[model samples]
Target: MSSKPLLLLTPALAVIGLLFGGGLALALLQSVGYLAALGQTTLTLDAYRQLLSDPVFGRSLLLTLWIAVASTAVSTLLALMAALTLRRSFRARPVATFIFQSNLPIPHLVGAIGILLLFSQSGFLARLSHLLGLIQQPADFPALVFDPYGLGIMLEYIWKS
Candidate 1:
């Protein structure tokens, strides 16, 4: 067997291993307080212990879990409803299906970037809101992407799903 395909995939596989694996390793080391730069050579679980002990961290974890569950539930319900509607005989079924499935081809990364650009404080929606007198300025727009409630993240998950 020719090794051409393997050779072609070598670079991509190398990159994936180097970047993804290295990054994860570095993060793990740092999480365990093994950062050499800060003179933290000792491997310890103090960081994790502190995080688990912190009430804020607990609340944040709970909030994240809640958002994940809520978004998944909402997306499932919406998808089910859409599927049921599309299954029924209708004159515009083809068009509706086409519109619905159009986003399936888009990459999640691209969709996430689009969501950030459209939902951020200074994004198109905020600008439009300003022009429509909904808000005096972009700052007046509520935080979406980096909000405390992870609203933008949930929105992206729901949209992508």
Candidate 2:
């Protein structure tokens, strides 16, 4: 709000903008096949063309979009449900709210890793299940992490959200 503060922040902001902008520019140039170190200066869209033409790439793109949309929808619905539930006057509200908010500050990568560790085949749940005679071995646990539907990723996103 003050000129003095703006002046003081100008240098750091400029440095950050320059570094980030320059790196993005370099990446774009390299993506277009303009790597100077490798002696390739010609810009072309051959890489992108190849990528677009690949059948596997198309499938991967579709799967990624589906996963993103599904996770976002599920997370939004869960958040809405939680908000509605928490807004009411009820007993154990403090405990429930605390438990819900406890993971709010965790980073996405950390939460994802935590989910992986807790849900993987050899994870604690699997071991507990085995110990309880519910599962025969770690492999008997369901494939939640590396499953075909990206359920683990959605779980991480929803939980972190």
Candidate 3:
């Protein structure tokens, strides 16, 4: 074969160059203040320093780690349970498989919204409770949507995953 490595490598090289080159350009622009608006050309390390020092960011990072750990642990347990359950033949296997596969086609965001609508204080559960005389009104419903410990996000991950 003729020596034509550049011709053979052009497409792959172009993709690699575009990805890294664009990332480097953006980084340089951000670092040098080139991307800033009018009269904001001052170069500083304030952004980096603030990011390193912020308490909220620190807590958020910790929360993210905990969420990831919890999700992984829960998913592993669930997968084990599913494996054990599937090991035994049952009449519900087809229905369970269908539900599991159906979930694959529904987007996570849609599931999150559905969960919110079903579990929120003014949601379907609350209405059902009121109709069953368990509660006087939606306002009397207990909190579930805006829980302080990120239950909603955790539930969404569990359902989606």
Candidate 4:
């Protein structure tokens, strides 16, 4: 009986091993080629040296790191708040969970577009402002979408994630 179960599981295990092992082998080969010159086959750290000296690459790396750190911190805080709130009140628990889980079904790009539509100068909010006499035209509204500070991306993350 035990042998039968093992036999049945063998193919699945082999498939998983092949998938992961193939990927690892490809990555290893690529990394080796990347670390060494193809013609001379001499190992060198030239790529790493270049990466460290490139200002644009450095700036992008720093921006990525900042975004990762900020997102992690915010997610931790939000998770704690959600847990505490759930413990205190059960009334909106289902609704809150539904809203949070619903975000998973929406693509990131769609969420970004929604944020842009809602918060951009020519967006729904701006139109509402115009209707309310807060702004004479959309062009008079301040920029929110694609701002240098990445407020649009942050808003999208907050809404979706």
Q: Give the winner by lDDT.
A: 2
What are the lDDT scores of the predictions, listed in order?
0.92, 0.93, 0.82, 0.78
Instruction: Summarize candidate 4's per-residue lDDT along 46-89 as a digit string, tens digits.
Output: 66788889998988887777766776678778878877876776
Compose the digit string of candidate 1's lDDT tens values, residues 1-161.
99999999999999999999999999999989898998889999987898899999989889989898999999999999999999999999999999889889899888889988999998889999999999999879999988988899898889988
> Residue-wise lDDT of candidate 2 within 54-150, one digit each (tens)?
9999888888998899999998999899999999999989998999999989999999899989999999889999999999998999999998788
TM-score-best of 2 and 4: 2
- Please give the ranking of all candidate structures by TM-score, highest first, separated by commas: 2, 3, 4, 1
TM-scores for the candidates? 0.67, 0.78, 0.74, 0.69
Q: Which segments of candidate 1 are over 4 A away from where they belong?
A: 1-48
Ranking by lDDT: 2, 1, 3, 4
lDDT for predicted candidate 3 compared with the true structure: 0.82
In candidate 4, stretches whose alpha carbon ends up further than 4 angstroms from where it belongs are: 1-18, 31-44, 89-92, 135-142
Clashing pairs in 4: none
lDDT per residue as tens, model 3, 1-161: 76598799999999999999999997976875665656677777878788879999989888888878887788788878877887788999988877766777789899889889988888999999999999999868877678766667777778777
Model 1, 154: alpha-carbon shift in Å?
0.5
